[model samples]
Target: WNIENIIDNATLKYSVNFVEDVVNLDVSPGASGIGCTEMVISNLGTITIDVDVEVSGDNITISPGAVSVTLAPEGNITTPICALALTRSEARAHPVSVLALGRETNTHLNQVQVTSNFTAIVDPYARLSIQAPMPAKHCIGSTFWTNFTGVNNGNANDSVVFEVSNIQELEDAGFTFTLPILQYQLEPALLDPLKQNSFQNLVIKVDSENVTEGYYNMIVTIATTMDGESFSAATTYQIWMANCQEQDANIEDDSLPSISLIPTLIAIGIIAMRRRY
Candidate 1:
């Protein structure tokens, strides 16, 4: 009997095959700013084969990196793999190797080298501006509202965060004010390229009663997070405070002469009418 030939024939009868030699993974930013790819493994052997899958790369990560499958004769298995960019600034091609090894024979049966190329599609950038009420004036112990506009100069969706700092520095500079809502997070919005969005009627309370009556200047900082990075911008706001008591006094003084002249004019009209009669 030819036992050696039989063994060689059996070894050559069973084999493994990959559907595609090279897989191209598009690591482009998705809804969650992450990228993913799907892969399929097929078995062309007559008997069930146990195969193990793995991926090797720095930026690319595969879910279920180790997959065990008992593929029937001419059966296939599908796997979903996801990858993300560690840093968004640099866009380049990342080559990753997906190797499938036979568990029983401990042999490398199939290899699919994937080239994940990420382009510099869009850069995240933000522009912030604030518009307050005309005259920027408020009385003591009063609340004022301002309008905030955030524009996404780049091609990505983002959220805006507002913060007020340097209160002590402003007070030392003879301008003291208070923000009722110090930290605010704006709702996330998908901004088109070079398009603007408005957050209307944001409130800020000024403590004019405790501070002196004058122009209070302070800095308002705006920050946004895009592609897991923080970018910030700042602007100065000038708020004028008027003493409530002094405003009332001025109103009364301006109207006092008009109130006194009413009586004198009535008397003069009566005297003139009597002389004519």
Candidate 2:
């Protein structure tokens, strides 16, 4: 019998599945974050397959972006793929695709490929900061007003409301607060191109008309919210309530924590990128 050679095409059957349809990521405002899940690849056909996996997304990165594996019939491989999102000032839902290419032993026989998708969700957050100038000493029974700043430190659009956190404390100490504007709408803070802080300015007025001759304190606060979550920030001060007629030596001048001015430019929202971190 004469020796003869026969050739036939081999089929590579494979299946791909993600652990879940959605992966949740909690990232700070203007920050990068990572989310990971398992992906399983199975070989179903009679022939072994060398499979290569790849993933892609917008403004985000997939770790081990590409992977290769050799599987036998009825064999499977499970690997974790991570999504590293880029710096963002707002929350968003992103869709990423997973593609698998299988070659029968890389023999270049016909190649079969499959594609699937998973969603990456970034959650929104709220943050705030308030700054006021505290004078070293103020004469008793004198009206005091100073310009202060309130910044929307969060990564989303929000409204900030101004209030006196220690109303009773200030009131009992013969002090009262009056503000022309109480609420303000602000946008996300930008770290670059001017280092926009989404900052707002207001004048704080206090009536020190009542008689006093001791140390007094007051707290100024700003508040905002996101998804029913409350966020509040405040600045406080302690002043020596000495009689205007008293000598300078009679006033206490110990400064606590040295509360100071708010810089016009604040570096905010430093996010991570590229690899799974």
Per-residue lDDT tens digits of candidate 1, residues 120-239? 122344444444344477776665555444433323345666666567775564444545553444432332233224342345554444556787765666666655556676666777
TM-score result, candidate 2: 0.69
Report the lDDT of model 1 for residue 160. Answer: 62
Q: Count the backbone clashes (under 3 Å) in each candidate.
A: 0, 0
**Candidate 2 lowest-lDDT run of ten:** 1-10
**lDDT (C-alpha) at residue 192 in model 2:** 37
Error of 2 at 255 (Å): 33
lDDT (10s digit) by residue, model 2, range 9-118 = 35567777787668866677445577888888878778888888888876777887888999998898888988876555356888888787888885756787778778
lDDT of each: 0.50, 0.72
- Tell me how candidate 1 scores on lDDT: 0.50
TM-score against native, each model: 0.40, 0.69
Stretches of candidate 1 off by over 4 Å are: 1-133, 145-147, 170-201, 227-230, 254-277
Given candidate 2, what's the lDDT at residue 219?
72
- List where candidate 2 sits over 4 angstroms from the true fold: 1-11, 29-32, 86-90, 136-142, 191-197, 228-231, 238-277
